[model samples]
Target: MTTTDRRPMYWEEFSPDSARAGAELACLRRGVGREPGNVPEMWRFHRVRISDHEARTGAPSASLTAEHAALTLFAVHQQSQRKSMHRQGMGLGASLRLLRQSEKYKKNPQALNARVNALATSADVPELAYHLRGLITQLRGIGQPLDYTSLFYDVLAWHSPEGQERTRRRWGAQYYDWAESKAKQPQTD
Candidate 1:
């Protein structure tokens, strides 16, 4: 899963120096081969866009290839992570908006705080308010309200199947942490 350490699997195994370019017909296959379902929505969308472009105008020019798009996609991921890491919670109105969206908001204005406190306790995340803020940001990042019918607490982190697991991969090997080591260490309970 440490694709950040290896060459993008889409172009690995075959040596570019030895491989001959295909003319008249080109087959472009790409995947987040690091881990199954680890591929992000942004990458999937980028794939589709590339597919559409190829279908309409054939393969991209040699100067601008899928590798460039892949780099752009990875850069987008990195930029998003950077922004998420430093982002703070919503202000008063936004916080109130979140509270109103809560299922129990009509019952109590403090309901959101209580729910966040409970979530923070179970998640072992310090700072109830701050945790709630980050959780909300994560929730928004995952998708639209119509995508899932669950309440906020119902979804802890809604990354892709393997991307979600990637987040739990531990501090030393975190994908978002550029400084994290990519060495395959033994897992301990």
Candidate 2:
């Protein structure tokens, strides 16, 4: 089926109750830092989907690139974890925000902030992926989860200038808006 006809099966769909979920995640993990189509092992998991997507478009698939990046990052983030890392509605910005708020980083946030700034300032996919690997590692250290599906779409959008601006704006809002909303909440005795 084409990408438009069916959404790619992400980690969230695999129930944690089954071993298949862990096995699939393990397959994806092997692709970390490797170029798409280079890892023959991961091809079974992602190749057919990408081929279907490309077939429909009749051109190189941007979504496939984004999918590879997001999948690899998810594998990293989910490493050694019992629960699924793909939390719905948890975007990259929100995940980073949680990392920023973690007690470990609360005392000294400069390094965390610097990493985030680097990610924000990345000019292209390769640069973004490089920066993301570091941040994703940090998030894993803190046991934070993110929505890989949302991240896939965001990364795809990042391919175009207009989409990149919009994605950046949305991420900024997600990152900074959380504090404002929390501050506005009514205090109770």
Pairs in clash, predicted candidate 1: none
Instruction: Residues 1-189, candidate 2: write the lDDT tens digits.
Output: 344665555665655667676777788888877776567667665632556656676554677678788878887887777777788899889988888889978888787878888888889887888899999888888888888878887888889999888888888888766446656989888
Error of 2 at 179 (Å): 8.4
- For candidate 1, write residues 38-65 as lDDT tens digits: 2343233221123465557655432123
lDDT, model 1: 0.30
- Which candidate leads in lDDT? 2
Output the lDDT of residue 10, model 2: 63
The list of candidate 1 runs beyond 4 A from truth reads 1-37, 44-107, 122-189
- Give residue 65's error in model 1 in angstroms: 27
TM-score of 2: 0.82
| Candidate 2, backbone clash total | 0
| Global lDDT scores for all candidate models | 0.30, 0.78
